[model samples]
Target: MTIPDRPLEIIWDITYACPLRCVHCYSESGRRPSRQLRRDDLLRMADAIVAMRPYGISIAGGEPLLVKELFEVTERMTAAGIQVALFTGGWTLRPEMVGDLARAFFRVSVSLDGATAEVHDRVRGRRGSFDRALRALDMLAGAGPVFGIDCVVVRSNFGQIEQVCTELVPRFPGLGFVSFGAVVPEGLASRTGFAEHELLTEEQMAAMGAPAFRERLRALVPPGVHVTATDNLALQMHPDRIREGQFFPALQIEPDGAVRAMPAYEGTVGNLLTDSPAELWRRSVERWHDPFVVATLTPVRTVREWAEATRRIDYHFASAADRERIDRRPAFAQL
Candidate 1:
């Protein structure tokens, strides 16, 4: 495969504030202090993003809707001809907002963990979240945006994905796809106490990314609907992707201004608030070759091990001023 000359996508997590604390949350979202930039910072960051102009940006969040001026930043990026996609928990997505979301996002994805409200709400840690999500889906149905489902296939939701897709397909006839994913051990899921009930086994994680497994799931869905299992574990296997500084194939900007190639790791290449995204990308390319990155990843033979390895690669800002400020962070440590 040809290595990309530039990033194909920028996955920007606009805000770290959310309405739910889902059991498998990678960022421990709602539990952490808010990482959203101020309105001015977001605008300045938007300007930098437009100028840098990677192929597209996926605007993800703890829940993007929580941000008051979210659309203003998205509108600016889209005006500059950058394609945008959105990811939300669907808690605050109003019916009126559906049309605007349709206009701004190339595709909008809403998370749903299970087929029934009982199962979905349990994963979400909110009593009425399942109803709100389904209500949001109903609001989006045939509303002009190409919409889809994002399901994290943990032990509880694993058996329900086929049902999640089949049951909803008729209700929302044009739903794009049901994207299934396994958990990454970080944030709350990383804790030994919490991992037992939800985390997948080593074998389950392997099978989740297997082509034969994906195809088998696809076979169960309707002709118009697509079923996909996310396969990012393969990125850890590709030395070229790591060597090229495209380990994620997307530049990840955490809720704070810190920009990183990989989110599971705390090593930030630069901050969008004070640095050029393009330069940060180049900096990231340079850092991957560091002996520690290779040494740490070499022994990670399974998805669980890789997830653990992710948090172990700690990097700090290059600016001396930044170094002083970054060292105090709870997430950062010397490797």
Candidate 2:
């Protein structure tokens, strides 16, 4: 499929610093206060990102809440008529903060790795994380913009997925969505991350890999609740849901005033301040044949591959849903 003309979503890591050091964190989310994006740098990035006219901006972090100035930045984004989404662990949310976020963001997403505190705290390497996350949900429910929860599907929680769905949905009927993300075993979580027992085994993956699992999960999802799995996780569905909105401007300005290609791909891409955002983007476009974007975007075809593989399975989830409710299907599918 051809890349979308404009990015459909842009993720702005408010800070790389996070409160918890989860074993399976992809961004290497940390609590290094020193890495926090500066106010001026954030404003500049925001200005450039808002100029891109993407569908929405996702504000993420080590924990966005760690950055005291996030609300201020969010305020500016809303004033600029930009839609925003916040990604947090929900440890810091308070009653008043929810009201403040409701006016600023389009929606909010919090992470909860397990249905039970024992499992959650162990994975997070912090005590009371699960309780705080639940409380955070209470504070977020109905008090602000729609909010949802993100769970990292692994061997430990795969069994509890149904429980999480059953327990959380009726508990907070106003949630915007629930996403089951496949555990990305990289970075700090690669070697020393979750113990072997915590990781999903091949057998469990096979069970979750079935077309029926996808169908059943969707059926179990509450109406108006979104359940998204990445192309890498469950490929038995539409390509657009997995790949349509995958691209974004591959540039980010760091906290220390250094300009770089995406934050995740920092260092490999030259600095923006030293080089020029426009020049970098142009070079990046010219270097499309280079590994980074091409390599990353190539696998997205998996989404379509999955959809085709499971075409025989009843696509009750896709066919019955309102077209407007779902993301655009892969361009090739329209062909």
Best by TM-score: 1
Tens digit per residue, CA lDDT, model 2, 171-207: 7858878877665432333222242444456566555
In lDDT terms, how accurate is model 2? 0.59
Model 2 clash pairs are: 17-30, 17-62, 18-30, 18-62, 102-145, 259-272
- Model 2 vs truth, CA RMSD: 11.9
Q: Model 1, 1-335: lDDT tens per residue?
A: 44455567788888878999787776557766777888998988888777766898988878998888888989989999988889888999987797789778888899998898888898888989989888888888888878888887777777786787668655776788788888766555554434555667777777787999889878877787778896456446335545455456567788777887555555577787788666787776565556777777777776666656654553332345434433432431111
TM-score of 1: 0.86
**RMSD after CA superposition, every candidate:** 4.7, 11.9
Cα TM-score per model: 0.86, 0.72
Clashing pairs in 1: none
Model 2 residue-pair collision total: 6
